[model samples]
Target: MDRFGDGLVFVVALVLIGWWIWRRFDNWLHEPPSSRLRKLAQAGEVEPDEAVDFLQEHGYSVLSGKHRVPLGVIVDDGPVQTTRLYFDYFAAKEDRYYLVRLERSRQPIDWTASGLRERLLPYALLFPECDGIIVADPKDRLLRTVRFRVEDEKA
Candidate 1:
């Protein structure tokens, strides 16, 4: 092969390898919990409804059945850009709101108290109106919560 042809081949191979690595990392990080739920369903271990059952069993009245809430944030362009935040479950019980963040099994479910606190901080900052945040993985049978206390905007 000519030198130019070999160089072109090397560039193409590098691009393909980079693309594969990117896809693998993306899948690892963003594996959907629904796929796990499907596995649970097939195994007859736990049905998808049980996620809500788990929440209800713990005293959270399901306020939203998978809903996206629109939020406005100021970007470099100056005008507020609308962004959507998706939560698996939005529940309220005893006058306090709870936002549930679900994780896939590949993602780390076990976290130190401070680690879990850090994970929920973004939800707290973005959705300050919510009273608390919870992270649950049914496959791992784990649940963690942090009461997110946002200062009143008036202050």
Candidate 2:
């Protein structure tokens, strides 16, 4: 009787494990494709973009340009407003992906810590996989990379 009970338990355990594996496999198979990074990587362009050239000159390899992600914001539980999070260029250096944002004359960047957090932190938070963000000012020839680190504080 004990032998039969052990066999039954073993069979049940196997069935549970198989069910969990199937669930994982099904989710993986039906998961949505990755964002534009894959598509841009696949597209081989003969013509070089100016932004790409700028990045290359600064020692970074440009992967793609004009990357945008659709964003929806709801304020005060009101209707959702659609906008875009625009990335001027995507580049790599030292095997790390960096999202590039070109500085515009009209909307100058605030170099202060608070201003930097308000303006640029969203990009880093949205793509936690990315190493950081590179802000390039072609006119003034400035290239800056920003990274965020969170440390636990002992209270």
Candidate 1 clashing pairs, residues 3+ apart or interchain: none
| TM-score against native, each model | 0.50, 0.69
Per-residue CA lDDT of model 1 for 5-117, tens digit only, reads 99999999999999999999999789864443333223322224878787777787765556565789997879998987666776667866667888876666447767766
Residues 37-103, candidate 2: write the lDDT tens digits. Answer: 4554444442486666778997898876776678999999999999998777777788777888999
User: Candidate 2 clashing pairs?
Assistant: none
Candidate topping lDDT: 2
TM-score, cand. 1: 0.50
Q: How close to the true structure is residue 24 of candidate 1, measured as C-alpha lDDT?
A: 97
Please give the lDDT score for candidate 2: 0.81
Model 1 lDDT, residue 37, Cα: 30
